[model samples]
Target: MTGTDAKDDLHQYLREAREALLWKLDGLSEYDLRRPLTPTGTNLLGLIKHVASVTAGYFGAVFDRPFPEPMPWIESGRDENDDMWATAEESREQIIGLYHRAWAHADETIEALPLDATGRVPWWPAERGGMTLHRILCHMLSEIARHAGHADIVRELIDGSAGRRPDNTNIPPLNEQWWLDYHDRLDRTARATRA
Candidate 1:
């Protein structure tokens, strides 16, 4: 494939991962969106916030095109995990808006530079500090996809809703009874194998 085609393909997958991550928030109330379903305080809005912060840094600072905003939480000497959860005052709209802005900033960096364009990740260890657009794209893709999986579980716990996106369930067609039987069979097998 040509260089432009390769970059477009990578960008497309990155967009898909971003969409899947954001889709987890649809049809949910503010409380549901910020509710911490996991013991580690994993919430939907917080995930979006964290991704925004990281994306801004990776695409902004690393590429020497800093995002035009202040992010005190990302500064040194701040509380740990500050980016992973939203404050009560931080509304759902605010965090989601920041995420969308981050997308635009990241996209600009991607468009302005080729995949082979080199950059530095100051937060990384010295030996691994140097990186390229291609590497950062893959890193961000993995990061977003991992959180999207977390969101899948958190959304399911908040309500029984699950799947990849709103328009596409991406799961086999099976009735409720079929799922129940499937779980029951697995339980039976585990019980039978118990020492």
Candidate 2:
């Protein structure tokens, strides 16, 4: 890809990943969004919240800039799994809206800065010094993609809904014959193990 095309591609991937993450929350109750998928309390809403915080950190505060809106959890010393689970006081709209706003802020930073532009990550390990906007954008996209995969699985478990975005050509179809074949193999395996 050319320079402009590569930037657009990366930005498009970031947007799609963000959308997929939010899509997992669609048609779900507030209770469902807050429900823990794993023992660590990873939930849909919490993931969005966490991403917002990290995005603000990398694209805003890390660049010696401040985000227009404040994220209280970072100051409240409750960041842990707080992003993965929503509290009673936290509404679905609020968290999702914050994520949308975060995307706007992150996009601004991406637009204004060049890939080679550098910033400090004070929280990172001492051995690793600061990083560039390019690196941070790549890191954010990586993080979003990882979390989006987790969201896909959790969404599937919740409603048996699974497919990729756009054309959804990545999804495979399984008919009743396939199910029967798989079950027959499982039954044979069970008989052999018992024998």
Candidate 3:
């Protein structure tokens, strides 16, 4: 109903997405967390790392408040895809820590600015680069939530564990056989449509 209410709502959703993205790494070995599950090399830890980098940018540099640390992987002429995966030397705690710090920094920015506060996205064209805090919040919520969904699928592929969150799986409470049968039915239907 009010500006503060809207901001709070957006913040809540963004926080949930961030948590869900991080939860995918729970109970995974280092190999499993970093192993590429998709053709493009999507992995749980990498997803967390990518989101951390993204959040730091949108909520950090975009708002004239750069993340306090230098991210060499994202700076200079580094490979654009370099931030999407973790190096063997990068511990899971490090990536997750970055994400958490990004969250705190981003939160500070959001709380410090009004919804109408303005900033420019350095990467965007000048004509469309101007943005309000509310706009950035919406953009970030969409971006983070999309990656959280990717984490969900990657986690499923890794261990057959499916859920939006640990507590609320958001899937049917059906038995394993039911799920298998459901998968078979979908497979049959998809194959039939190929004719």
TM-score of each predicted structure versus truth: 0.95, 0.86, 0.98
Question: lDDT score of model 3?
Answer: 0.91
Backbone clashes in model 2, listed as residue pairs = 46-83
Best-performing candidate as measured by lDDT: 1
**lDDT of candidate 2 over 1-195, digit per residue (tens):** 575676678888999899888888889877777778787777778888888888888888778777888776777566565556667998888888889888999999888887778888867885675898878878999999998888887877787666656357256678768866987999999999984
Q: Which consecutive 10 residues in model 1 have the weakest lDDT in total?
A: 164-173
Per-candidate Cα lDDT values, in order, are: 0.93, 0.81, 0.91
List ranges where model 2 is wrong by over 4 Å. Answer: 166-169, 176-195
Question: Candidates sorted by TM-score, descending order?
Answer: 3, 1, 2
Which residue ranges in model 1 land beyond 4 Å of their true spot? none
The digit string of per-residue lDDT tens for model 3 on 88-148 reads: 9999999999999999999999999989999999989999999999999999999988998
- For residue 66, model 3's alpha carbon misses the true position, in angstroms, by 1.1
Decoy 2 TM-score against native: 0.86
TM-score of 1: 0.95
